[model samples]
Target: MQQTVVEHMDRVAEDVVALTLRATAGDLAPWDPGAHIDLSLPNWLDRQYSLCGDPAERDAYRVAVRYDPLSRGGSEYVHRFLRPGRALGVSLPRNHFPLVPAPRYLFLAGGIGITPLLPMMRAAAAAGAPATLVYVGPSPATMPFADDLLRSYGDRVRIVETGRHGRPDLHALAATLPADALVYCCGPATMLAAAEAAFPAERLHAERFQPVARTFGPDTAFEAVCARSGDTVTVPADESLLDALALSGRPLPAGCREGICGSCEITVLDGTPEHRDDIGAPEGRMFPCVSRAVSPRLVLDL
Candidate 1:
């Protein structure tokens, strides 16, 4: 973990604040679009926020967080208690969902999901790439950096404030996107699912802010072997392989633990890995963070 001191803090909206932090220890690592850093606050709570500033700025990192009333008060603490000059431990930036190169890009953001898209939009503009951003929020007042986004992107952006109207037309967005554009979405499960249904997987990228509740389908059971420890564990129908691994004191390297983040990705030595995540898919690997084994037996390079 690397320690960083908050250099500045600014409120962009009633419930949203932007934090600019400078590394207090070693040099910070480089990050790409859709990268996030795990922050360890003073109160022993861990929170992950996406990087929203220029990726080239390694020594200084910028993030915007929204306060969710339903959330366990992590955003509230960051907005209320965290201040400039305060020090906090931050993990190296990790990218679970990254922007894939394409002729054009279509970005869909819901509320706080806009945090990551801001930097991506800037990067796209800088690269002279064709991109369009659709940001949905409760209202103009509740939306973070609404004015900033408009001013920066001008006509290339679309803001759908649902507080006044009901909800934005997802069908319209699906139809309006360019044919050859690579679609990227980050939002609630419902929005992601809708996007997935609207746009078939020809070239769709998504990052889930919350994991969808999985109902185990009828599938054959599998035996998971921990390659390093050589410990074998049986995955029963009643439990997930991840849960079984945790029960055996073999904790997988996970961040969200909900399968949204790809932090717990492992190598697949044998057996078919039932890929269930929306993150990047490298060949012959599996994201244990949210994926399950489809085959009867599997071996993992833990």
Candidate 2:
């Protein structure tokens, strides 16, 4: 954890505020493109925001947050109460949406999802790699960093206003991409679903702000055996495995219990797991926050 002070705040768009935070004591942690830091807010709320500024600048970390009318206090607090000089607790940068090496890259960002791809676009241009960005938003007025992006990348950036022109045909765009080109997308669930269907699983990479529909059936009561402690806990059908583990005297570190954050991931030593997280961790590992056991008994490495 690091103590950061909000050095600057600006309303970049209609409901989006861009924040610049600087460390109070030491240099801020270095981060690469596509990295995000968890901001700890009042009322025990923690939300993740992508680092949108230049990665070479070690003195400050920049993030743009959009105010969701139905936010769960995270965005509302930042918009309403956060100001310059305010101290904030922030976690070290974590990157699950990393930019992989590719001959060419196609970035598709929807709404505020453009935050992470902003830094990526800069890195790609600096490397002299062939890259293109298709930024889609509800309207021109609500889009953050639109002017900066247009001014910086001119012809490389394509703007799609969904309000003016119904949703852009992502399938048509995907069809035009080169065979070896990597497609990175960050946006709403509907956009992600379309991308997933248009591109191959190996070629398409995405980051989701919310969990998608569960493909599993109804939950069932199961037994979890802690491999290290040799303790068994019965997980109720209506309860999450994380909650059941806590009730059994074994509490795990968790953030964003809705399965968006990969904080409470535990190894599955034995038995199958009904994976429910959007994090896409492979087999043998499961997010206990929303995932449950599929077999009668699960042997966890915890």
The TM-score values for the models, in the order shown, are 0.84, 0.91
Q: Tens digit of lDDT per residue, candidate 1, span 1-302?
A: 78899998988877889999899975688899889988878777777899988888878899988888786757778977888999988888888777777778988888878888888888788878999888888787777888989998898888887777766676777787777888888877777888888886877788877766657667556799889989889887767777788888887655666666666677888888887775655777877656778787799886
Candidate 1 matches the true fold with a TM-score of 0.84
Q: Which 10 residues in a row give candidate 2 its minimum summed lDDT?
A: 253-262
Task: Report the C-alpha lDDT of model 2 over 1-302, residue by residue, as the tens digit.
Answer: 88999999999999999999998987889999989888887657888899999998887899999999999899999999888998888888878789998888999999899999999899888888899999999888888998899999999999999888888897898778899899999999888998998888899989999887767898999999999989999999999999999998899866788787776778999999988888877768999999887799999997
lDDT of each: 0.80, 0.89
Give the runs in model 1 whose Cα sits over 4 Å from its true position: 173-176, 218-223, 233-250, 274-281, 289-292, 295-297
Q: Where does the lowest 10-residue lDDT sum fall in candidate 1?
A: 253-262
lDDT of 1 at 225: 88
User: What is candidate 2's CA lDDT for residue 24?
Assistant: 90
lDDT of 1 at 234: 88
Backbone clashes, each candidate: 0, 0
lDDT of 2: 0.89
